[model samples]
Structure formats: C-alpha cells, structure tokens
Target: MKVVIIGAGVAGLSIGWRLLQAGATVTILDRAQPAHGATWAAAGMLAVTAELEGAHAAERDLALHANALWPGFASEVEQASGVPVGFVRSGALLLAPDAAALDAMRARGPVLDAAGARALVPLLADGIAGGLWAADEAHVDNRRLGEAMTIAYVKAGGALVPQTAAVRIEQKSGAAVCVLTPRHRYHADAFVIAAGAWSGLLGDIPITPVKGEMIALAPPAGAQLPGPVIWGNGVYLVPRDEGGQKLLLVGATMQEAGFDTSLSPDVRDQLRAGAQSLIPALKQWVLADHWAGLRPKSPDGLPLLGPVRSGNIFVASGQFRNGILLAPAIAQLMADMVLGKTKIIPAFDPQRFAPRFV
Candidate 1:
C-alpha cells in the first residue's frame, strides 16, 4: 500500500519507518524541519508510575506499556541510524520544599530526610525537607533521538518532504484520497494526520497548542550536578550528562497561549529561580539556552489515535506531555491499524469527541 503521512515530527517519522518496514511505500510531509515541534523541546522523561498517579486505569496501563517498549525501541533506532540517543535509565528524584510537599511525595514512594536526599543529590538546597526516589524511571536525549529517527526513516526507503504545508485532505466517495498542498498534491491509498498542534487545521479534530517555555544551564567547571531527574514544586531539573556536557534542563511554564513560540524574559527568570531553589549550586552555572514549543493537548488529556470519520484517514496526534514516552507504542499501533491487523483502543478513539471531516 502507498501511504502519505502529514507532519514529519516524531509521530510521523516513526510511523513512516514502521510502515516502510511493513512493505508500504510511505511519504511524510512537514511544514518545517522534522522534529522541530514539541518533540524537540521535550525533556524525554519516561516516568511510568510517577506521571500516572491520578490518571485513569486505561491511561496508566497504556503508559506502562509504552515504558516497557522504550529499551527495545531505543536500541532499534540506534542500530538502524548508527547514532546514540543518550538513553539512560538513571531514575528520578522527587523533592519536597516543605512539610506539606514532603507528605504528598511520601504517599507515592519512600520519603527520605534532608540528609538522605543530599546523599543522592549533593547540591540539593538546605531548605528541602525530604525527597522520594523512583528508581524505575528513565530519560532520553530527545534531540539526538529525533535525528536518529529521521535518518532511520529515510534510510529505510521512506520519503520526507520538508517545508510542505498540507492544507487539507482531498476526499472522493467519502474516502480520503490525497493530501492537498500549495504546490503539489500527494495521492496514496491511506493518509495519516500526525500533525502535533496543527492537526486541527486539516479537519475538525479538537486539538490545541499548550505553550511551554524552558531554559538550559551549564554547570560550573569541575562540578557535577546530579545523576537523576529532580522534580519539585512544579519544576523539573533534567540533567544531560552524555556527550561530555553537564547541562541541566530546567523548565517549564505551561500557558494557553495560541501558537506563540517566542520566549519570555520573565518566564526565564522564574525558571532560574525555581532551579536555584531546588539545587542551590545552579546559581553558579551559566545560562546556555532558552526556548519554547507548543504541546498538542486534547480535552480529555489523552492522545487521539486510530481512524476518524474519513474511512481511510487516521489520526495519531494530541499526545500532550507524554508524546516522547508514547512515540514507540503509538508508531506500532498506527502501523498495525493501517495494515488492518489490530483494533483501536476505545478510550483513545478520535470519534470520542465527534471529529468532523472537511
């Protein structure tokens, strides 16, 4: 089968790779460079249990399944592209700024005193009352991962068209036949809309962009920050130690601003303050970079996967915060659906929100 995928981010690229492996000729179209959307700005956390505390049972199970698939997925991508994605199962540390926060963290896992927390992360501030260590969580360097996926997809015989904006899906007899673009039209047996925040532009999918701002910091000379990810007080400090760099990613501020990628000075200062409050030694580090990306969010806070009203068109967007963690599983599920070998999960069906086709 010939398949055309919209949006060459992680979802579209990964799905293209899988479809190519399944003997389908694939073409991926993107408005900009691949992986320049939410995938590039994410902190690549695979926190299976820590992020699923208040989530529904189906969501939790899906997250766990995705987490289980990461090790193999990372290995495959690395081998295929001959690039290291900096995948690490270094675990995560959850900090509590006060007694109340400590109590809340204790409910999730074993809480350690200030001294114990300091033993794991020496730079932790004295104001920290306690912490909870989740040893099963993991993280990946998302920038490297995106590059590797792009290389693998192209090497596997998939075509990528950058800077091509898909205006809409052209249909005939109630079936999607091609994707309409400004300069060209792409015809295929199947169409997959994997556009992140821009999925709604083609049809009536209920997806919105949630803007997030983040800052990167370089540690002082001869000083190592910490091993695990630090989560505390609505701020997360992710350490990137691979490739001979001791950089900490401190983020992020979530705002409902529409399609704005500009950075804010106030948000940068707030992120710096929050990072220093958690790790006092960061005050001596240098600010390396700051930027923003828009996350595609749905009303139910879960991804919209599988076929929509258009018989041959499928959607694999609205992954919100867990897009990185869920990419591998989503690619497999989407490929299976395209091959007519699997059933869609009821909770994530696109029709749940009454999607309209143009």
Candidate 2:
C-alpha cells in the first residue's frame, strides 16, 4: 500500500517507519526539517505516573502501553539507525507542597519523606513536605531520538521530503487520493495529517498550539546535577548529559500564545525561580540555553487519533505534552488502523468533535 504522511514530527516519522517496515511504500512530507519541531523541543520525559496524573482512562492506558513499549522501541530505532538516543530509566521525583497534596500523590507511587527525597537527589531544598518516587519513570534525549527516527525511516526505504508542506488532502469518491503540496502532489492510497500544531490548518481538525518555554541550567564548578528528574513548583528539571556536559533542563511556561516561539527573559526568570524553589542551589547554576516549542492540544485535552472523518485520511496529532512519550504507541496504532488491522479507538477518534450546523 502507498501511504503519504504529513508533518515529519515524531508522530509522522515513526508512523511512516512502521508502515515501511510492514512492506508499504511510505513518504513523509514536512514543512521544515523532519523532527525539528516539538519533537526536538520537548524535554523527553517518559513520566508515565507523573504526567498521567488526573488523565482520563483511555489516555492513561495508552500512556502506560506506550511506556512499556519504549524500551524495545528505543533499541529497535538505535539498531536501525546506528545512533544512541540516550534512553534512560533514571526515575523521577514528584514533590508535593502540602500534606494534603502529599496524600493525594500516594496513589501514584511510594511516598517519600523530605529526608528520603533529599537522600535520592541530595540537591533538593530543605523545607519540603514530601514527594512521590516513581521508579518506572524514564527519559530520553528527544533531539537525538528525532535524528535517529529520521535515519531509521530513510534506512527502511521510506522517502522523506523536507520543505514539502502539505496544503490539503485531495479526496475522490469519499476516499483520500493524494496530498497537494506547493511543489508536488503526492498520490497515495492513504494520507495522514500528523502535522503537530499545524494539523488544524489543513482540515477540520481542532488542534491548537500551546507554546512552552524551557531553559537549561549548567551547574557550577564541583557541582553536579541530580540523577532523577525533579518535579515541583510547576516545573520539571530533567538532567541530561550531552557531549559529556551535565545540564539540568528546567521547564516550562505554558501560554495560549498561538504559534509564537520567541523566548522571553521574564519567562526565563520565572522558570529559574521555579527550579530554585525545588533545588535552592539552582540560583548558582548558569543559564545555559533557552528556547520554546509549540505543543498540539485539542479542546478536550486528549489526542486526536485514527481516521478524521470516515475516509482513508487519518490524523495522529494533538498529543500535547506527551508527544515524545506517546510516539511509539501512536506509530503502532496508526499503522494498524491504516492497514485495516485494528479498529479506531473510540476515545481518540478525530471525529469526536465533528462540526455541527447551527
């Protein structure tokens, strides 16, 4: 089968790779370089228990399933692309501000006292209540993962067309025929709109862009970052060793600012403050890097998966903060749906928010 997937973010690239592995001819079109969007800008947190807090049942199950698949998925991508994506099982520390909040956190994992939390990281602030220790939490080098997926897809015989922005889907006889781009029309048996924050622009998809800003902090001389991810003060500090430099990634400030990715000093200070609140020594950490990315969010705060509106055209967008974590599951499910091997998941159906006539 011939398949054309729009957007070349992790979702699109992974799906294309899966389809190619299944003997289907796949072509991925991206407006810019593949995986340079949210997939690159993400903190790469595989916080199954932390991220899924208050999440609905379907999304929770999907996240857990994806988390379970990540180990094998990382290995497969690495073997295919010959690149180490820096997948780590370094767990996470989620701190609660008060006793009531600490009690609520117990449902997710073991509750750690303030002393215990400090013992795990040794960088945590003193005047803390308690936190949850989620041992199953993990993280990956998202930027490296993107590069690896791109290489893996191409190595698997999939055509990747960068700078090819798909404008619209051309349909005939109630079936998607091709995707029309500025330079060329891509004819295929199936078309997928996985264009991250831009998915809504192409069709009736209700995806919107939620902008998030992040900053990296490098420890001072003789100081080192904590081994596990630390979450509190409305920020998550993810430790990463890039090229032998250990840096703490402090993020993020969520805004309704549509498609605006410019950095702000005020936001940077705000992130630093949040990080310092958890780890007071962060005040001495140097600000290494600051950037922003747009997350694709739906109205219902759930991903839009499977078919868009009863045609071969499908959508695998609106993953919001979980895009990097959900890539493997999205790829497998979308590939199965495209191949008629599995039914569309009801909770994630793109047709859930169908336009109604007044």
Candidate 3:
C-alpha cells in the first residue's frame, strides 16, 4: 500500500510509521517543518482523566485508548530513534483554590475519582478546596516527541516532503486521484488528510479551527512546584524536565474563530493571571514564550477520521484540544483501517460527519 499523508505533525508522522511497519510505502507532505506546528507548541499532557469535561462519549473513549498507548509507544520511539520523548508518569494535580473553583473541580469528582464523590490529589494548601489526582495519566515533552517521531518515521523508511503544501485534493472518476501541490502533483494508492487545522479547507469537507492560546514559564532560581501536572479550572501547569521550568499551558477559549492564530496579549495576561491564582507558586515564574494554535475542532468535539465521501481520501483531523493526547491511538486506528485491519475506534469514522445528516 502506497499512502500519501498530508501534514507531518504528530497525527501524520505516527500513522506513517505504522503504515511503513506494515510494509506500505508512505510519504508525508507538509507545508512547514515537521512537527513544528501545534505539535511543537502543545504542552503534551497525556492526562485523559484530568483533561475531560463535558466531552462526547466517543471522544472520551478515543482519548482513553490513546492515553493507554503512550507508554509503550514512547518506549518504541525512543528505542528506534535514540531520543527520549520526555514521557512522564508523574501524575497530575487538579487543584482549585477558592469556593467557585473548588465547586467546579468537585463536580468532576464523580467522573475521575474512585468513589462516588471525593478529592483525588492528596495535598492541599490549607485553603485548597478540591481536585482530582490522576496517577495513571501524565504528560510528555511534546517538542521532544515531535522531533523523535520525525527521526523514527524516517528510520522506518517513510518519505517526508516538508514545505510542500497540498493546494487541493483532485478527484477523478468519483475518487481522489492526486493531491495537487503548488510545485508538483503527487498521487498515491491512498491519501490521509491529517492536515491539522487546515484539513477542512481541503475543498472536500468542512474543517474548522479552534483557537487555543498558551504560554510557557520557567520558574526562578531555587523554586519548584510539585512533580505532578496541576490544573485549576482554566489554568494548568506542567513541569518541564527535572528542574523548576514548569510550562504553563491554558486558555482554551472556544470561539468560532477562523484560522487567525495570532496571539492576543490580553488573552495571554488573562491566562497568566488565572494560572498564578491557582498555583501561587507560578508568581515567581517568568514567562518564556507565548503563542496560539488553531486546533482542528469539529462540532461534536470528536476527531473526523476514516475515508471521506470524496473516496480514497481519509480525514484524520478535528482533534481540537486533544490533538496532542490523541495522536498515538488515532494513528494506530487510521493505519490499521488503511491496511485492511480493524479500526481501533469506530466513532471517529468520517461517515459520522457525512453531510446527509451531519
């Protein structure tokens, strides 16, 4: 099977790796550097239990499956590429400082806690109201994972054509024939449109962007937060490496913003204020960087996966906030489906978004 995957980010690269392992010819085409998009910017929180809210049932299961695969997948990638993805099992702290925040956090207890109602994370700042401690879920250094996956995919004999963006998906005889790029027309036995936020703009389907603003903070000298990833409503912090450098990633303002990825200082400050309030330890941390990513989010919050009505072209996007968390499992399911194997999750199938009743 010859597969041409669009977008060389986590979703595309991981799937390419699987397909190549299955003795398939894989070529990944991207408009920019591999994994440099949202993948590079993501905080790499693999916390399925911590990152859930009023998400769809299908989305929850898909995220859970992907979260389960990260440990083994991380080991395999590190072995293949000689690079550690900074995978951490340090668990997570769902902390809420005040009454309002604690109320919201407490509401999630029924879903994340073992008992009918209880606090998960053990410690409290005396006034720390309530939260969940997800010991099984954690995070990865996404930057390392992206770089590692690129190396792994290449070592697995996958061809990567960076800076090559597909202009459109061309159809012939009621099926996708070739992906028309500005420089050349590339055809393959199959095509997987894993083009992140740009997947919907492929002229075949309605893919939209969900803007997520993030900030990175490395704490000052002789100061360190706990090892667990901490979340308090809108603000969350994940420690980077074995130091005080904790990357603060938050602010998932879900508006129907088109593809405008420019960062808003107002939004950044608002996020910073919220994070500092939750983790007062964040007050000493200096802001390292700020950026925004337009995550591909669908109407139902579930990713659009499986073959499209355009034929021969599969859609693997609309990951929304869970793009980083869902990468590994989504790749496995898509790769298997493309190779005549059983899909890892059926609800992600693109047919669910078909126009007839979508």
Candidate 4:
C-alpha cells in the first residue's frame, strides 16, 4: 500500500516507520524540519502513573500500555537506526510543598515522608512536606529519539519530504486519493494527518495549540542533581545525560497562547524559581537554553485517532503533553487501524468530536 503521512513530528515519523516495516510504501511531508515542533521541546517524561490525575480510565490504560512498550520500542529504534536515543528508566519523584499538597499526592499513590523523599533526591528542598515515588516512570531524549526514528524510517525505505506544506486532503468518490501542496499534488492509497497543532487547519478538526515554555540548565562541576524526574510546584525537573554532560530540563509554563513560540523572561524566572525550590544546588547551575513549543490538545485531553469521513484518511494527532511518551503505542495502533487489523478505541475516536468536524 502507498501511504502519505503529513507532519514529520514524532507521531508521523513513528507511524511511517511502522507502515514501512509492514511493507507499505511511505512518504512523510512536513512544513519544517522533522521534530521541530512540540516533539523537540518536550521534556520526554514517560510518567505513566505520575500523569493520571485528570485522565479517564481509557486514557490511563493507554498510557500504561504505551509505557510498557517503551523498552522494546527504544531497542528496536536504536537497532534500526544505529543511534542511541538515551532512554532512561530513572523513575520520578513527585514532591509536595505543603500539607494539603502532600495529602493530594498520598491520595494518588504510594507516597514517602519528607525524610524519605529527601533521601532519594538529596537536592530536594528541606521545606518539602512529602511526596511520592513512581519507580516505573522513565524518560527519553526526544530530539535524539526523533533523529533515530527518522533514520530508521529512511533505512526502512520510507521517504521524508521536509519544507512541504500539505494544504488539504484531496478526496474522490468519498475516498482520500491525494494531498495538495503549493507546488505539487502527491497521490497515495492512504493519508494520515499527524500534523500537530496544524491538524485543525487541514480539515476543521478541533485541535488547538497549547504553548509551553521550558529552560535547560547545566549542573555545576562535580555536582549532580540526583535521581528520577522531579515534579513539584507546577514544574518538572528532568535530568538529561548526553555525551558525558549532565543537564537538567526545567519546565514548563502552560498557556493558551495559540501558535506563538516566544519565550518570556517572567516565565523563565518562574521556572528557575521552581527548580531552585526543588533543588537548591541548581542555583549554581548554568542556564543553558530556553524555548517554547505548542502542544496539540484535544478538548478532552486524549489523543484523536482513527479514520475520519474518508476511510483511507486517518487522524492521529492531538497527543498533547504525552506525545513523546505515547509515540510507539500510538504508531502501532495507527498502523494496525490503517492495515485493517484493529479498530480505534472509542474514547479516542476522532468522531467523538463529530459536531466540530462537520
């Protein structure tokens, strides 16, 4: 089968890889370089248990299932691309700043006393009342992962066309037949719109861009910010180990700022304060980088998957914050649905928002 996927972000690249592996001819089109969107700026937290507060049962189940697939998926991508994506199973620490917050964390899962939490994360602030430890949580270097997926897709004989903006899906006889770009029209047997926030622009899907800003910090010489992803005070501190460098990703300020990717000094300062409150030693760390990206969010906060009006045209976007964590499973599900092996989950069905689509 010939498949053309729009958007070369993690979702698109992942689906492309799976389809190509299944012997389908694949082409991925992107308006910019691959992984240059939310995938690039994500903190890469695969926190299945840590991020389930507002999630429904199906969403939680999907997250857990996706987290379970990460180990093997990471290995497969690494083997296929001959590149290390830095998949880390370093667990996660959820810290509460006060008694009320501590009680909330306790209600969620197994929590530790202040002493215990500090034991695990030595850099934790003394004022922390208590928290939880999610041992199964993990993270990956998303940029590296994106690069690996791109390599894997190409090595598996998939095509990637960057700088190509897919303006619309061309349908004939009630079936998607081609995609129209400014310069040319590309035909394929199947089309998947995995364009992140831009997915709504194609065919009136109700996906919106939630902007998030983040900062990266380099640990001071001979001192390391220890243990698991740290979640405290509306921010997360994710440690990144890349090429013998120990860096921390401090983020993020979530806002309904549309497609704007601008960085604000006030937001950066707020993030810095959050980080220092979690790890005081971070005060000495160097401010390395800061940026923003737009997360494609659905109204219900779950991904939109499965076919639209056109059977062969599918929607696999609206991953929001968990896009990096959910890439492998989302890809597998999308590939299966496209190949007629499985049906879309009702909760995540694109038709759930049918009124908006119409």
Candidate 5:
C-alpha cells in the first residue's frame, strides 16, 4: 500500500513511521523542511499528569495512554535511529505561588495524585501552600525527537518531498485521489492530513489556529532547574537537556487570529514576567532564544481526528495544547484505523462537525 502523509510535523512523521512498520510504502509531503513547524518549537514536555488537571475524563485517559506509549516508542526509535529522544522521567512540578492559584491547585490534587504525582515530582515549600508531584509523566528533547522521526521515516524506505506545497486535496467519487502540489501530483491508496495549524486550510476542516509564544533561557547561576516541567500560574518552564538552557514555554493565549507566528515583545515580556511569578528561580536565567508557533485549535477544545466524510481522508489535528502529548497515541490510532483494526476515536471524528453527517 502506498500511503501519502501530508505535512511532515511530528504527527506526519509518526504516522509515516507506523505505516512503514506495517509494511506500507510511505511518501511524506511538506511545504518546508520536515519538522520545521510547531514540532520544532515544542517544549517536548510529555507531562500528562501536569496537563490532566481540569480536563474531561476522556481527555485525561487519552493523555495517560499516550504518555505510557512514549517510553517504549522512544526506546524503539532510539534503537532504530541510534539517537536518544531524551526521555526524562523527572516528573513535573505544579507550583502555586499565590493564594488563589494555590486553592485551585489543591482542588485538583486528587486527579494528579492518582497519576503518580507525589512519586514523580518534588515537594513544595510550606508557605507556598499548594503543589502536585506528577511522577509517572516525563519530558523529551523534542528537537532531537523531531530530527530522529524525520530521519527514521526516510531511512525506513519512506519518500520525503521537502518544499512541496500541497495546494489542495481533491476528493472524487467520495474518495481522496491525489493531492495537488505546485508542479506535480502523486497518487496514494490512503491520505493522512496531519498538517499542524494548517489543517483547517484544506477547504473543510473545522480546526483553527491558536498562536503560542515560547522563550528559552539560560538557567540560574546555581545550575539547572531540576524538574520535568514547571507549571505555575501563567507559564510552563520546561528544562532542556542542553546544559543549563531552560525553555520558558509560556503564555499560550488562545487567540482566534489566523497564523501569526512572529513573536511580539509585549507577549514575550509578559511571558517572561509570568515565569518569574511561578518559579522564583527564573529571575536569574538569562534570555537565550525566543519563538512562536500556531497550534491547531478548535472552538470546542477537542482535536479533530478519525476519518473525513470523504473516503481515504483522515484527520489528526485540532490538538490545541495537547499536540505533543497526543502524538504517539494519535498516530497509533490512525494507523490502526487505516488498517481496519478498530473503530476510531468517536468524538474526534470529523463527522461530529458535519451537520448532515450528524
């Protein structure tokens, strides 16, 4: 079977990798170089427990399953590519620096506690009044992971077409035939639409673009910030394995504005200052690098996965804030569905957004 995966982000590479394992001939198409989009800017924090708070039961279960698969998946990819994905089991710290935040955190402690929080993270200071230790969760060096995925995809007999913009997906006889590119066309038995924020741009997808800005900083003079991911009031401070350069991935403001990845000083300063409020240790980390990416978002805050109304057209976008965390399981499910193994995740099916299909 010749499977064509559009967009070479983590979702695309993961799908291609799985399809290759299933003995499918895979071809990946991307507008830019593989993994250059949101995957490049991701913090690589696989902190499911940390993100589980206030999430619906279904969402939490999905996150937990994905996190569980990560260790084995990372190990397999490392063995195949001979490069570590930098999986960190240090756990995530959810600190509450103020009274209101502390109160809210305490309310959600039981859910995180059940996810092995206490065993995974550090105990907080007494006066701080609130914290959760999500122990089973982990983090990864996303940059290396992206590179490894793309490398492994190509090395496994998969074809990669860089700088090829997929202009449109043409559905005929209720099945996807071939995607239109700038200068050529390639037919496929199956098609996976895993384009990040661009998922909705494909004519009928319901996904939207939510802008996210992140900054990397050199750790304080004392050394690295020892943790998986630090989530306080307004920021997510994720540490990088590269020496003491910590990634201050902060202020994921949910904006409906279309595809503006350029970082604003206002957003940057606000994010940096927000991190300072969370972990006081951040007051010393020197600014290192800054970037922004668009998240595939939706009004309902749920990812649009599963099949499209048209045949051979599947979606795995609208992940919103859980794109990185959901990568493994989403790809696995996509492969399973493509192989006719089981019913896809029902809620995420694109049919949900279709008035007639409903």
Candidate 6:
C-alpha cells in the first residue's frame, strides 16, 4: 500500500518506519526539519505512574504498555540507525509539599520520608515534607531519538520530504485520495495526519497548540547533578548527559498560546524558581539554554488514533505531553490499524468529537 504521512515529528516518523517494515511504501512530509517540533522540545520523561496518576483507566493502561515497549524500541532504533537515543531507567522522585499531599501520592509509588527523599537526592530542599519514589519511571533523549528515527526511517526505504507542508487533503467519494501541497500533489492509498500541534491546521483534527517553555541548567563546577528526574513545584527537572556534559533540564510552562514558540524571560525565571524550590543548590547552576515547543492537545486531553470521517485518512495525534513516551506504542498501533491488522480504540477515535471535525 502507498501511504503518505503529514508531519515528520516522532509520531509520523515512527509510523512511517513501521509501515515500511510492514512492506508498505510510505512518504512523510514536514513543514520544517523533521522532529524539530515537539519531538525535539520534549523532556523525554517516561513517567507512567508520575504523569498518569489521576488519568483514566484506559489511558493508564496505554501508558503502562508504552512504558514497557520503550526499552526494546530504543534498542531497535539505535541498532537500525546506529545512533544512541539515551534511554535511561533512572526512575523519578516526586516531592510533596506537605503531609496531606504526600498521603495522596502514596498510590503512585513507594512513599519516602523527607530524609529518605533527601538521601536519594541530597540537594532536595529542606521544606520537602515527603515524596514518592517511582522506580518504573524512565526518560529518553528526545532530540537524539528524533534524529535516530529520521535516519532509521530513511534507511528503511521510506521517503522523507523536509520543509514540504501539506496544505490540505483531497477526498473523493468520502475517501482521501490526494494531499495537495504547494509544489506537488501526493497521491496515496492512505493518508495519516500525525502533525503534532499542526494537525488541526491541516484538516479538522481538533488539535490545539499548547506552548511549553523549558530551560537547561548546568551544575556549578564539582557539584553533583540529580541522579534521576525530580518532579515538584509544577515543574520537572530531568538530568541529561550530553556528550559527557551533565545538564539538568527544568521545564515546562503550559500556555494556551497558538503556535507561538518564542522563549519567555518570565517563564524562564519561573522555571528556575520552581526548580530551586525543589533543589536549593540549583541557585548556583548556570542557565545553559531556554526554548519552547507546542504540544498537540485534544478537547478530551487524549490521543486521537483512528480513521476520520473520510475513510482512508487516519489520525495519530493529540498525544500532548506524552508523545515521546507513547511513540513506540502509537507507531505499532497505528501501523496495525492502517494495515487492517487491528481495530481502532473507541476512546481514542478521531471522530469522537464528531460534528466539530467533519
């Protein structure tokens, strides 16, 4: 089958690679450089329990399944592309401000006293009353993953067209037959919109761009960085080793601003303050970098992973913040669905918000 995917982010690239492995000819088109969108901008936290504590049962199960698939997926990508994606299972620490919040956090993981938490991360502020240690949590280098996926997809014989923005889908007899672009028309047996925050702009996918800003911090000389991800103060500090240079990535301010990726000074300061609230010693850390990316959010805040009203056209978007963590599962699921090997998940049906999309 001939398949054309819009959006060359992680989702699109992974799905394309999967389809190629399944003997389908696939072409991925992107508005800019592939994976430079949310895929590159993510913190790469595989926080199944930490991030999905209050999530719905289905979403929780999906997250767990995705988490389980990550190790194998990372290995496969690295072997295929000959690039390291920095998949780490270092776990995470979730700090609670008080006893009540700590009580509520027990269900997420093993409860830890203040001293116990500080033992794991000595730099933790003294004010932390207690915390949860989630051993199942992990993280990846999302930027590296994107680059590796791009190389793997191309190596797998899939066509990847960069800077080629798909303008619209042309449907015939209630089935998508062509994608109209500025320079050329891409005709295919199937079309998939995995365009991250830009999915809704292409068609009626009902995705909105939620802007997030993040900052990279380098610890002061001779100071130790947190061994694992620290979640607290409305932000997360993810430790990364970029070519032996240790850095802590503190993130993410969610704004409903549309498609604006400009960095915010106020947001940067706020992130630093939040990180410092969790780890006091960070005050001496140098701010290495600050940037932003837009997350594709749905009205129900769940992924849309099925065919639209137009039969042959499908959607694998609305992943929001979990895009990196969910990439492996989504790629397999979407590929199976496209190949008629699996069924569409009802809760994640693209047409769930009916009239709004059609």
Model 4, 146-229: lDDT tens digits are 899989999999999999999988877788889999998999999999999889998879899999999999977798757689
lDDT of 5 by residue, 177-229 (tens): 88889998879988888888997777677777877778877765656455667
Model 2, global lDDT: 0.91
User: In candidate 2, how many Å is residue 97 off?
Assistant: 2.3
For every model shown, what is its TM-score relative to the native structure?
0.97, 0.97, 0.89, 0.97, 0.90, 0.98
Q: Rank by lDDT, descending?
A: 6, 2, 1, 4, 3, 5
How well does candidate 4 score on lDDT at residue 80? Answer: 95
Candidate 3, which ten residues in sequence have the lowest lDDT sum?
113-122
Model 6 lDDT per residue over 252-294, tens place: 9999999889887999999999999888889999999999999
Across 1-358, the per-residue lDDT of candidate 3 in tens digits comes to 7889999999999999999998999999999999988787677888787767777788888888888888899999999999888898887766655557656665555334322112433332345555565677788988889999999999999999999998887777777778889999888889898889888767546677877788877767766545777776567777777333455455445556787888888888888887766656666778888887777877777788888775578888888778888888888888998886875356677777672111
Q: What TM-score would candidate 4 get against the native? A: 0.97
Which TM-score value belongs to model 1? Answer: 0.97
Error of 4 at 35 (Å): 1.3
Residue range 26-124, candidate 1, lDDT tens digits:
999999999989989988888775677798777777888888899999999999999899889988888877888888887788888889888899878
Greater-TM-score candidate between 2 and 3: 2
Q: State each model's C-alpha RMSD to the native.
A: 1.2, 1.8, 3.8, 1.4, 3.7, 1.2
**Total backbone collisions for each predicted model:** 0, 0, 2, 0, 3, 0
| Better structure of 1 and 2 per lDDT | 2
**Candidate with better lDDT, 2 vs 3:** 2
lDDT of 3: 0.77
